[model samples]
Target: MTDIDLNQILTFVKVVDSGSFTKAAEQLKQPKSRISRRLAALEKALGTQLIYRTTRQMQLTETGKDYYQRCAPLIQDLENANNAMTSHSVELSGVLRLTAPEDYAKMILAPLLEEFLKKHPKIKIELVLSGAYLDLVKESIDVAIRIGTLKDASMKSKRLSSISSIVVASPGFLEKNPAITKPEHLEQVPCLNFNVGQKNRWRLVKDKQDIRIKANGSVEANSPELLYHFALYGRGASLIPEFLCRDALQSGKLVHILKGWTSGAIPVHLLTPAQKDIPAKTKAFMEFASARL
Candidate 1:
């Protein structure tokens, strides 16, 4: 091909991602006819069909899939390079895509974003709230605020904060049961478990020694808030993040148990794919979350 058309390829990629000429045009802010013509020109240049068009939708052919996988990263890298050059500006611009857990997104991040948007009106952020671990490279996400520890060696991680899990129970429940003085005594109490692991097993440590105890409980939940509610109603003892239960503990709604022992410290991480030129938007948002959270 004569000086392979980069713009045409970008337009084609946008069309493929959007799955419609009109949608691509809206995203690219171009005319629909222009997008159609660009895709046609790209196909002619490659001398093979890239997309299989249908009345209702569009699908990528085998060659198109390969090309997309190759070009998407290149296009993103170029955009990142361009963004990096302007990253030091006082005013933030462009899109910032972030991913984090559901509770953090709701209880912590949503309020922060509300204040952030008020300060910087030019930036647009797309927040994906999920419980599963996400691949930043495959999804083209700018940053991820992860809760646990980081195991991936390919990414740059900054420890935002350390969260320690606190075991709590209602006054009435504790009144019925004896005070928890040792780790083994927990077996006698009704324990509310989160999504950490099996119902009966809890990993804890004391005096530089690790201990695993089999906990018994009637209430099991996937959410910390639900467990908090259950503990409030005298259902069972629950281990939850200190940030979530600090207020409740102060108000005497929940009583902290085993004050001398600790469950573990969960490191909150801010992860980003190793890129040469991180965008200003991403950097600004990362700094904001780091400063606030």
Candidate 2:
């Protein structure tokens, strides 16, 4: 009798799953004769029949069922162990690519990332910041920090929080329009929008109704940093994130407007591609940022 090999056991499992010797042979990239020969050898070596085969079906024997249940998890564990060891070597000390929106990158993620770098000194992080949605697989990014709504179904996500949006203006700008009290009053005042050359429309919800208002500011920019500086110079009222202007509102450089109406909150999420198992480095970063962000 021939000795049973590990490859034979794996091939047996595949053949059982595929339910046809020809199909299993095709999947394993081998000839049907060789596949049948291997299974016969495996059964001979074990001194018992594993599978009872028919023309249209293949069913496991009692011994085969018990053996498979015992061996499948062991095979999976061995594969996982191999992958973990190899990934730690290929992944731990290499660069991890990430992406995010500019405002979140500059104001929220940068400082937190700096601290993370200090902790994992060997791993390098490269960040791509943009307002448009980035393709995680096409860009080969390990992860992305995104705000607003996440509509992509192909990726996995862990939500950080729902950040509040506030209507803010420079104290001097608010001084010029002192009659503002409710949400609809925004239509009468000079408003700022950050769409650059695009249409300057602002949407907010109050008392279960959605309202859209067109902005009428003298300045516009694609960059939130530029818009922030413009708001500081008393250009006009800009709708901005509460977290971004938290210090300014506290310091009285900017004042809150439309206190009764709000654009609601946007969710922050950490997204990654749909992989079989997440890598150790990606898992580490996710755990760190999930708590910190």
- The number of the candidate with the highest TM-score is 2
Q: Give Cα distance to truth, residue 288, candidate 2, Å.
A: 0.7
- lDDT for 283 (candidate 2): 76
User: On residues 174-285, what C-alpha lDDT tens digit does candidate 2 reach at each position?
Assistant: 7777567766677788777778433788777677888877777787777766777788998888877777888888999988877756767778999999986787778778
Q: lDDT tens string, model 1, 49-71?
A: 99998778888999999999999
What's the TM-score of each model vs. the native?
A: 0.66, 0.72
TM-score of candidate 2 versus the correct structure, residues matched by position: 0.72
CA lDDT, every model vs. true structure: 0.83, 0.81
Superposition error at 85 for model 2 (Å): 10
Supply candidate 1's per-residue lDDT for 260.
58
Q: Model 1 compared with the native: what TM-score?
A: 0.66
